[model samples]
Target: MLTVELGEELLIIKSEQPLKVLSSAMLNPGIGRYQYFVNRTVDKNYYPEDAKCEYEQFLQQYTMPLQMTVAMMTAVQQRFVMREQYVDGETTIDVFITAGLGNAVDVTQSYQYTYKPAVGTINIFVFVDGDMSDEAFIQAYHCIIEAKVKVLHERGVIDKQSGTIATGTSTDSVALAVKERGEFHAYGGSITRLGALIGKGVAATLHKAIDGYDAYQKGELR
Candidate 1:
């Protein structure tokens, strides 16, 4: 099973047993750096305590109940009034998304503003149960990416050959946690379930985030 806990700044994803974990993030130069690596999970200590503490402190300065956090949680489940902490995939999957669309762009007109920097970024983390091959993992990642772009297009933020809606952002990260040695085909049999749910989760979340951005830009969010 996978465990997901949403903190003020960080999103903690872990598995019940030892599994393989891969994480990547594109961060700004001054905020800090995230080391990329592929490692087997023997225990639940994935992130460093000190860095985690600093992240929380940094997050406190922002407004409470972050819109990104709310969007992510809301994607997987309906209703955000009870401070609900998770979206259970019935032990099959767990996904989380964080969005900051301050630098959002219309893929068609991004060339007009190439020199400007993005104000924020989005990070998504996913956890899946079952033993999967390296190929399967890569395929899953691609599925998630495809879903993200599709969502952006659905909102008119992206168009055919218009590039990406998150062009100027510094970080758009994805972390996948897959269980080790399980009862699943390792030779590319059935990875659709994993990909499909993740796609749905991301699409729903990104739609909400984009909607929020539109509201703010029109002076309706405040």
Candidate 2:
């Protein structure tokens, strides 16, 4: 089962197919969503380029429930701390699952839904230590933390406890938090690949979670 939770929002994927990411194309909304050529404004804070710096990202035809994407989404969320003023606020984000455009540069695309801003698809809510509502950041953190823990658990980089999160620590704190006790296995190569997936997935999921307004009724929004 693949679960995506933001605050109280939830998106559970129980499909037999593994979560897949075909591609990642990015566009920045600079001038309040109505301005043209937003990314070309040429101002410091007007529109900063993506931290990744890649114009387009293409992925293997992996299945859904992409644990990596989930991890990245979590990290992006944690990148910012909400301030009393909106300037300190985080940017809104969304994710789309398009079935087409799998094998073409000039392909047509269809978006699936407008993900609600909350973490989970459900309506549950969370309160951070402060009176801030940075649920997006918190949820993204959870995704990275969980995905790292999962990776370390698989690679035996950290010890884990059965029926619970891992018990040992890794240089990667997120992975360490999910430590468990089990047979030690070392696969640094595989672990590295998985770690990349977790990191990017966290960012993507963060964008999708806060993207679109009517994501729950994805069909309607589409």
Candidate 3:
């Protein structure tokens, strides 16, 4: 590690022989007299401006879909209260719209949360990243809620201490959903993070498509 003092900031460069390389550095008069390579041993080179243009073009595709996703989140939060502190830490996504296929109506926004108590009358927070259509969102949501509730019930996430049906103001988990229809929904419905996983099913489809009719033998793809 070697520190070279730039005009304002010091940049640390890693090299086997920093001082020797710096001594033989050539000051290229491009944009500014910035020494990109320590020595004249760079395999290839291009003008900085050219490289910048290429990078900017490459980044344009990712910008729109990510932006669309987040913008929808903000709008949804105003009406539907979801998991508080959604999209916290870990992987923070920045989505921008790539394209809206036909009448698909870009309802691609989503958010996630992990409530501590996980049940009872509580507000589930959501952090969205795009604008969503109300019709599509509701349709997807109700389907998910019903499916999850059934699965959760079968999986024993909701069951009374007694063997009989839970009734008479003794709503534990089911009551939570009834009270907070928009928030704290049981199981996952539309507009849930599970959709993200489902979205990635495209990758699996592509893999299968590309590898279809493969000639594999001896535990190796051919």
Candidate 4:
């Protein structure tokens, strides 16, 4: 089983066993086997010239083996983070997301706006209780990205600079983790069962997170 803990400034996900993880996170990125993943919340105005150093220093507060953890940071508040679980027989997937659209963007367009402190970001963390090959893991990651973009498009999220549907925020990030146990999967795509579950879980969780953030912005939610 996987456990999720929310702190004032952090969200932590720990698995009963180590997992094969692939992520584009600021801390402990890339493909690795990990037992823990984290999303730390920073102030919306927080920005550091050396983000690498900032991540390293922030991680020092934890006692877990840093190498066994994958971590990402976001400006979204912890109260707005959302989670969803999808289960199909023996397979289970958990999706956790924190989203803010202030920096939404259309990837095909270019902008020359001055660099500013972080205001918004969308960070996704997915945990699957299944064994997947390296190829399948990469495919699952791609599927998650597709789902996110689809939801943004459907929601009519527009980029301020391009006036077009945003594919994602400029600082968006995701981490996909698959357990080392369960029936091995060779392919993970929208058509496959594993990928389908992942896609649905991410789409639902992300949508809810965005809605929650919107409410927060309007003072409808705290």
Candidate 5:
């Protein structure tokens, strides 16, 4: 079973079974300055010695619960936090995003200037209730990335060269949780709807984050 909690300054996901954190980025410690923030906030002692070196265990034990708090407290804090719940008949998809863009950039301009190490970070977590296959997971990931880039572009945060999202290092991350089915094993039923909902939710959440960035730039928000 999967559980969610929204606290005064944190959002947490508690699960009975171990969940996977899958992304091309290095979320184990995050990237650049974001990496330092995660390292400072996470309780390394939380994990057993045996699991200390394991990335997945570290996330489940440390990052998932503590990173939110850390992001909230950091000086160049995360500007936006959004959560969306999508329901289609019996299936449900929940999307969560936390964006920190202090190192944001225009992908087009990346090549022109010798920039610093890591770029901004976006943490996306998706929870689903349904059965799915490995292939479906890959395709769904593609959908999430596309939607994220689209939202960045629509909100005027794209790279000048790529015309997509600004290029970054191993900072962005994603966590996908799926529920298991009973005796009769079947798949491919929820991918399409789940993908659509996840995409829309992620895009909308990112837009909100962009709004915060705009406000900060205008000195309306801190």
Candidate 6:
């Protein structure tokens, strides 16, 4: 099972048991066994000379196992975070996301200049029940990124610098956690059931998070 908690400064996703995780988080990046994943909300103007120290300090507030946690930071408020879950037979996928487009960028564009302080970012955290092979874990991560970019394209998100579709924000981050139990799945792709669930869950949650952020920006949501 997975539990999600939204606080003023943080969005936390906790699994009942330790999970094998592959992540691009600032803290604890790479494959490991983790039980807690956190997305910390920082100011839009946040810029730190020592990011590692910054993350360490922010994480000290919680009593969680610091070494067992994967953490990412975003400028989007935690209140605007969105979540979705899909369950089929013995498989379950849970997705949590927060999005902001202030620093959107096209992956194919090469820019000499970029936004300073990088105000916006998209952070995604996904937890899947059951064991997954290392190869499948990486494949699942790719599926999540693909789903995110697809939604951005469908939404017509533009990169102001390149005047092209934005693939994602410059600081986008994602984490995939798979419970280390049950059958060891070997494949994760758009055509696979597990991958389909991941894609669907990520796409749905991202759409809601984007819409929610837009509404908040326009004073439509409080």
Report each candidate's C-alpha RMSD, comma-separated, in the order given: 10.3, 20.5, 24.8, 1.6, 7.9, 1.4
Candidate models: Cα lDDT each: 0.46, 0.23, 0.22, 0.86, 0.52, 0.87
Top lDDT hit: 6
**Which parts of model 3 are misplaced by more than 4 Å?**
1-119, 147-151, 161-222
TM-score of each: 0.56, 0.19, 0.21, 0.94, 0.63, 0.95
Give, for candidate 5, the lowest lDDT window spanning 10 residues: 31-40
Residue runs of model 6 more than 4 Å from their true location after superposition: 111-115
Q: Which parts of model 5 are misplaced by more than 4 Å?
A: 1-11, 24-79, 105-114, 158-170, 182-191
Clash count for each candidate, listed in order shown = 0, 51, 26, 0, 2, 0
Write one digit per residue (lDDT tens) for candidate 1, span 111-190.
65543533444456555656667777777677767776677556655312345554323335566556655445343222
lDDT of 3 by residue, 136-169 (tens): 3343334422433332333333223333221111
lDDT of 5 at 208: 74
Q: What lDDT does candidate 4 reach at residue 80?
A: 79
State the lDDT of candidate 4 residue by residue for 78-157, as single tens digits.
Answer: 77789888997678888899999998888877455543444788999998887887778888999999999999999999
In model 6, the worst 10-residue window by lDDT is 110-119
Q: Which pairs clash (backbone N, Cα, C closer than 3 Å) in model 4?
A: none
Q: Candidate 2 deviates by what RMSD?
A: 20.5
Quick one: ranking by lDDT, best first?
A: 6, 4, 5, 1, 2, 3
lDDT of 2 by residue, 84-180 (tens): 1111122211222211100111001112232222221101011111111223333433545454334334433311112233312211112111111
Model 1 Cα displacement at 95 (Å)?
A: 1.0
**What's model 2's lDDT at 79?**
14
Q: Which regions in candidate 4 have their CA more than 4 angstroms from the true location?
A: 111-117
